[model samples]
Target chain A: MFITSIGYYIPDGRITNSDITEILVEDNKEHFSKEDIEFLTYSCTRKFEFLGIETRSCCSEENGDHFASMAEKAARKAIDQAGIPPEEIDCLIFSGVTNPFREPSFAIMLAHRLGIKTGDFFDINDTCNGFMKSIDVAGLYLKSEKYRHILVATCESPYDLKNTLKLDIHIENTDQIDNRLSGLIVGTGAAAMILSSDGGKGRITHYGEQRTSNDWDASMLTLPGTAVPGAKYGDTITGFWSDGRLISSSLIREMPEFILRKLSEWGLDAQSIDLFIHHQLGNNVTFALMDKLNADHQKAPVNTFKQFGNMATVNIPVNLAIADEQGLIKKGDSILLLSSSCGLSYALLHIVW
Target chain B: MTFDEFKLMVSDGLGIDDTLLNRDLSFRDDLGIDSLSVINFLVKIEHKFKFKFDVEHIWAMKNLGEIYDTFTEALNNK
Candidate 1:
């Protein structure tokens, strides 16, 4: 199976770190340290301008159409670059943490927008690791010889109030600096990639996963839309609290070793890989993972944390597209994509360019 | 800092118009500055002032006045 094309999009609005900090001070007066602001600012994936809406354009509650619109733009670009027609697509997948509606998969909406009716479309909610999982599933379908072309799209407007609510809570409780600091670096964005069986541009070599559960810690980071009973009420009614540092500590402890083991299984060392495209969770986690894998810092894809922030699922593909645009990857380069999600799911994929 | 000096710093840092710098304008709102712009400004600030402002502190600043104040404070402290 070949990885044909990739595309990404971010909303027009821009929100700086200072913008968020100014808003946070209205609810909580506690002063945040420079480290705290850097971590939190880096966590946001998008910077939305004031559009006179309840939430910014990047927020989940702003509009479902925006997500669909951006997803369609990226999908169209990817298909065009791959030199494939929309109707030729056999399968389409939309995976991410933020979805416009609970019912009717976003993939179906994307497929409709792209005018691709001859394909099977679905959505995946694997959070950070969704893209890698979708790649594995698409690869299997490609190997079946029944499908000729597949489109995998992942989008997350993490800046949305629905999604940002979790981040907002973590940021508001700045006095609990340790926990809030950890979750503050993930930003919001969207990405799409086309997969084909006809030997296109890029190819997937191997995919692996390692899972560990911290069910007790599952409540550490809860989105506002969750069905958790007590949380059904408003934020004032039910005190919003999450220990992000606790979650990151667990992830940091488990992920590096898991990724290293997966790479070793393929008999490939860090030096063999040309680029490392991680989840874009944060600068800290990225550096920590690099140190563990003994990977060179220069070889890693540009981390948008300092710019766009953490964009959850869109992080990987956005970086990939930017690298591609900058000619960062050559014909035979090996790219390693890894992600660890909230369910304690860790996934890794090796791509041969 | 003098207005001319501030305009030079922001222009050299953000690659935007030096004339855009108004004493009353808010950087976060009026100028529509984002994180990337903030980072670019920080890099230039470090080079020009020979000091690094705390990124988190910089992240917490809202307007141009606040940024100017922070930079001055950092320079003074340095």
Candidate 2:
């Protein structure tokens, strides 16, 4: 399936480093002394620099923005760009890292918003690689001619307090600061794409995925499934519960192998790729990946994590939008969309624009 | 989980080969896993074993043997 059009929506409310620090100090006054607060504030500033993030969008809670609303906004833009009406979409896939609830999938909710009555619905939760998996699945359906247009969309609101664990400032170990701050790294964003067999100028030439489930538990998230019947009232989500060192080590070791194997088996070389769209994990991990692959850093640009933080599965599409808006990628450019997630899931999609 | 199963899980979760996993081996030196992973692993162990380790109790363990022994101690205490 070819990517006919891409569209994105990041909430207008921005959260800066200072705002986060203030929240930390204000929320945990009993646990931290004045000096400790200063130290923690300084630490938060360093974290911003270390993670390569300056600001991130938070969905306006006061405006009553939820996943369905965000997805509707993004999907409409993509449909408009593709010049295809909502009814023409053969399939609706709510593909991403975060699905707020198991029932009433984003596809159904989004379809309702678009005033479309019918389409095959699908969902994937491979975390960060989720968007690519959706495209891969959409491609398979397209090959049969049974499906012409598939709308794949993602809206992650990790910053939504209900979806993530509140910051804990009670710990005495200063070293735990980085781990505690990780929850803040996630931001809210949405992106949608119209993919068709015979659609836009961008052609999805190759798609691949791999896993090292040998250690999938290195990261974990416990959502209260707030909307689920079994969930109790006053429940909440416990998120960003991850082992970063283990994850970074494995990603550092495995990502190169993944990249090399894909390039070799496909008879393609790294130099041929014009743009590399990767999971916005962080600057250290991402840049380390580029350096190890011996890729030109300029070509594999990493400007999104700084601007939007880690929007999880939406990172790739958001990066693509940034590249398009910045004139970094244009028609005829070869693009590589590589994704890595908490479950040790990985997917790579090659696009010829 | 048995001690062997726990060791295997550690190997599996850390992406360390089975050959490198042994009670005598230090989790830090032999596996090259950082302190954060050790804490994360200990937490996982608690979940699987249905037991909780005191903060200081988890802090002092070093090699795989100590990890196994500490849990055994917890069992004996219970």
Predicted model with the maximum DockQ: 2
TM-score of predicted structure 1: 0.69
- Residue A316 accuracy (lDDT) in model 1: 84
C-alpha local distance difference test of each model = 0.67, 0.74
Docking class of 1: incorrect
Residues B1-78 of candidate 1: C-alpha lDDT, one tens digit per residue: 766788787877667698878667765446645333455446545655667666446544667777788777877799
Name the regions of candidate 2 deviating beyond 4 angstroms: A26-28, A32-38, A61-64, A161-172, A224-237, B1-78
What's the TM-score of each model vs. the native?
A: 0.69, 0.75
In model 1, the runs with Cα more than 4 Å from the true position are A29-65, A161-174, A177-186, A215-242, B1-78
TM-score of chain B of 1: 0.75
lDDT by residue for model 2 over A64-154, one digit each (tens)? Answer: 8877778888889998999998889989888756676678776787877876679887677877777888888899899999999999999
Q: What is the lDDT of candidate 2?
A: 0.74
Report the lDDT tens digits of candidate 1 across residue range A1-353.
Answer: 78888877776565555555555543344556666555434323122211111122243345443666777878888888888889999999889776665678888888988889867999877767888888889988989987878899987664453343544443343334333333334455678898988677778889998766644343233444445543312233222334553455556667778877887889998878899888765554576567667888788857665566667788888888888889999999999887777666778889898
DockQ of each: 0.03, 0.09
Summarize candidate 2's per-residue lDDT along B1-78 as a digit string, tens digits: 487876777787667787767888876446656544565556545555656666544534668888888877876776
